[model samples]
Target: MKPLLLIILYCAAVTLPLLASWLVGGPPRPFRHELASGLGILAFSMILMEFVLSGRFKKISTGIGMDVTMRVHQMMARTALIFAMLHPFLYRGTASGGQRPWDPTRQLTITTDFYDLSSGITAFLLLPCLVLLAVGRTKLDYKYETWRLMHGIGATLIAALLLHHTVYAGRYGSQPVMTWLWLVMTGLAIVSLIYVYLVAPLRETARPWRVTSVTRLTPGQWEVTVAPEKHPGLDFKAGQFVWLNVGHSAFSLKENPFSICSAPAAGSKISFMIKELGDFTRTVGQIKPGTIAYLDGPYGSLTVDGRNEPGIALIAGGVGIAPLLGILRELRQTGDPRKVKLIYGNRTDNQIAFRDELDEEDVTYVVSEPTAAWQGEKGFIDPALIDRVFSPLEIKEWLFVMCGPGIMMDIVEDHLITRGTPSRHILSERFDYD
Candidate 1:
């Protein structure tokens, strides 16, 4: 499950169809035409593989981390777009028209069959729109759920079009063996989508969860807890997260991911420290207790369990503290003997959540904009603050787990590297994937 191994497996899956297509016997064609076909095959294969990559498979996300998995998904989509864009242009020198009796194999003549060519044209147009919308999702005015639904539907349509075009028009794909392979691969991609929306929702409907309590932790932050109804609670590691759906059907796309803020040892009720940030999140304060809720997670690889480091360093910015708080509470309730310290940062004093429970002896609360009454550390959670809190030996030897704004994570990670901490020793989760 190491990262390199995952990459190797992924490369094999995406390139397998391309390799097979090339291996199938065919009359010699110009290198440009063959290259075009190969690129098209590779693009479609990569597009289908995107479904598996974005399917939230723990085998992939848990191994390389969700941030890396998502990043790879985005990069591959763009790469596939480039290949798809260039595919047809490279075949310009080949003869194009209706299929001829003389060139039955499509060896010397490109197909001008309207249905076959139309599918390819449709996919080419739709693929760019899908990629552009995804790249600019945050810039547009739309709900995250709305954007998610559009993205899913668009990608599925493009996949179907690409499959039809590949099997019907492709010289290699017209072979019985290649046609079967394309069908199987495309079927698997659709199955992944079905599993997410249909199969998983059906299972969740059987084991429902309900809102147990909602407590205001700060001005804009609330801790909402959900308890299993007639069921044992989720069995998850300390620093994982869940996709929470409150007051929505199990099949709804209104779910939003939030890290578990309460410890597993705290009992069957799991709580999330949510800030008013979006359409769903901004209304968290109004979500009454006893409302129905559905959970689909315990995802992410941010836990420090079983680590051999002598000290554990937790760094957080804003509500990114949710998962870290779970880790901190777990370490305490279990009476973990390892030395632990926390550096929680915020822009203003009132933004810090769960301040009462944080053991002042080990927690450093940093505020960039402190009121006159402020007494704790002032300024950003930068290298200077980090150096002030952690010893040189602890910096190099201890485990560093962090989740926060992208800027803060980058700064902390860069500083950790500068302090000679091994990359493996530093763990981080990104709140905004955009």
Candidate 2:
């Protein structure tokens, strides 16, 4: 589906509960009380929707690029946190007591019952902590897998707590129609989690892969190739990535996203150029050639399969060259007539991967900290290097696909825009959403 339609659907889904609550009319309450209820309803709905926005669903992520989808997820999460934090405070001045005989719909008095309020209190305390941990995950001293597990568990617990609070303590939610709506919404959220952690793993288990080779490309980088055991292998575009689980259980959280460095035309075998960063990546060189593995993707929107641009510009920094290499390889294999050029940058010349293969292409090798014997472009892949590499007409007309460090991408994107390149022609995927 198109991005605009997906966005429209997302907005409609998130606001469905609030619209339903408003339609289920009750005795009129003060604006403050209604506002509190509305905020609470919206917050709960958005939280439930976060499961789908986790970037696991291809329908959502593929249409809007994984980076864009993740950015939306992060922004919406913070927004929902704000709404939830203000929900209870807005009801402070409203009447609160046991259910009164006259207030059948609980319009005149808010519930003070321990059972109804306990869940809300607990969720209120936990919500901020969850958001804070997520926002500061990279800075925290924990494994990525550990953070992922904690985030999943914490979100599930909070959702359950909020469900109880909303259906029991909420004035609008207490109504039968609204109660049913909340229950259904929460059920879907749980189902989404199950689909990701359970169903997907089961499917991956059935279609396993075996490592064929592990070749060191640089001091800190290795190329790991895997072939499907019996299946025909992944049918993915050239520049996509997959969640690779090597020598681990299908359901393990040890999997990490790695870009496909091999072209789709390169047969059923797939290759990933991994850098030794941290966590699972640090163990890439240690992995044996015949180890069992599972793949749970082919996700990302960094391909140039059907573009009509006159040329293609590939910009890379460090390990970001993985996906771009796949694209370049596919273009060469297909005998594509369009012009292609690559600008690959690294901290040092020794850090560049696939030197023999890349040297065969129209590549500009750049090193931020070059050795005395180093040649080619020096310094980072900045505006000056970009201007030196491509002509003004090429910058405006060529399709630019980049993946790299956040700062490099930011600089490249800004320069591309400044050089009269339309946003639609500039494509990038980020490793870090923050």
Candidate 3:
């Protein structure tokens, strides 16, 4: 779906509970009380939607791109945290008692019922801890898989608590219609989690793959290839990525996201250019050729298949060349007529992968730590290096695709805009989501 429509749908979904609460017709309370309830409703709705956002839904993330999806996921969690914090404080001035003669439903007064109110209190405390943990996930020194599990469990607990609190403690939530709505919405959120962790793995179990090759490319980088065990290979775009689980069950959390360095038309087998960075990746060189594997993907919206740009420029730093290599290989394999140039940068010449395959006529190699005998570009891919390669027209018109460290991407993107390149013409993906 179009991005604007997706955003509109999201806004409508998030606000529906609050709108429904207002339409249910409750006795007028203080402005602060209603505002508190409204904020709570909105926060719960957004929190529920966070499940779908991070659930790896191709329809949602593919439309807006995964980077935007993840960024939105992080930002909205903080927003929901703020709203949840303010929810109880706003009800401070209201009376707390068993049953009031004027308000028999207890709609105007804060309920003293510990059973229903305790859930809200628990959620209010746990929500901040969850957000803080996520914000400091790397600093916590927890394994990514461990962090993912905790994040999921923490989120599920919070969701359950909020659901009970909303249906029982919320003024409008006491209504049967509103209670049912909350149940259905929260059920969908839980189902989203199940679909990702359970359903997707079950589907992948039937179509397994095996490691075909694992060749060391650079000092710490390896090129790993996998072939389908029985079924036809993955049908994906050129620049997409997959969550690869090697030597593990389909349900295992040992999977890691890797870009498909091989083109779609290359063959039935797919290759990934992986750098040894963490626990899973450091062992890439030791993976046996016949190790069983499961792939859950073909994700990412980085391909340029149907774009109308006259020319394309690829910018890469270190192993970030993986997806760009896929695109370049596809263009060549399909005999694409569009002009293409690659500005591949690394710390040294030894770090450059596919040196024998990179077309000399089209590639510009930049090494930050070049040898004394080296003669290629000897600096970073900054604005000066970028300007030295493309002309004014090319800089402004050609499509620029990049993937690298956050700093390099930011520098290149800022320079592209400074060179009069429209924002639409510059596409980038970051390797580090944290």
lDDT of 2: 0.92
Which 10 consecutive residues of model 2 have the lowest summed lDDT? 98-107
Candidate 3 Cα RMSD after full superposition onto the native fold (Å):
1.1
lDDT by residue (tens digit), candidate 3, 1-434: 68899889889989998988888978888899888999999999999999988938888777877888888888899999999899889888688978979888787888888998999999999999999998888788779999999999999999999999998888898899899989999999999999999999999999999998999998999999999988998999988899999999999988999999999988999999999988899888889999999999888889897898999999999888999999999998999999999999999988989998995549999999999989999989999999989999999999999988789999999989998999999888654556
Please, what are the lDDT tens digits per residue for candidate 1 over residues 1-434?
78899989899989989888878968888899998999999999999999998836877787777888888999999999999999999988678986578877556778888998999999999999999999999899999999999999999999999989998889888888899999999999999999988998888898799998888998989999999998897989999988899999999999998999889998999999999988998899899989999998767888887789989999999888999999999998899999889999999999988787885539999999999999999989899999999999999999999989898889989998999999989999764556
lDDT of each: 0.90, 0.92, 0.91
Error of 1 at 91 (Å): 1.2
Q: What is the lDDT of candidate 1?
A: 0.90
lDDT of candidate 3 at residue 333, scale 0 to 100: 91
TM-score of every model? Answer: 0.97, 0.98, 0.98
Residue pairs that clash (backbone atoms under 3 angstroms), model 3: none
Model 3 lDDT, full chain set: 0.91
Clashing pairs in 1: none
Rank by TM-score, highest first. 2, 3, 1
Per-residue lDDT tens digits for candidate 2, residues 1-434, read: 69999899989999999899889878777888888888888999999999999999998888889998999988999999999999999988776886678886567788889999999999999999999999999999999899999999999999999999988888788889988998999999999999999999999999999999999999989999999998999999999999999999999999999999999998999999999988788888899989999998989999997799999999999999999999999999899999899999999999999899988999999999999999678899899999999999999999999989999999999998999999999999875855
Q: In model 1, where is the ten-residue run with the lowest total lDDT?
A: 98-107
Which of the numbered candidates is closest to the native, going by highest lDDT? 2
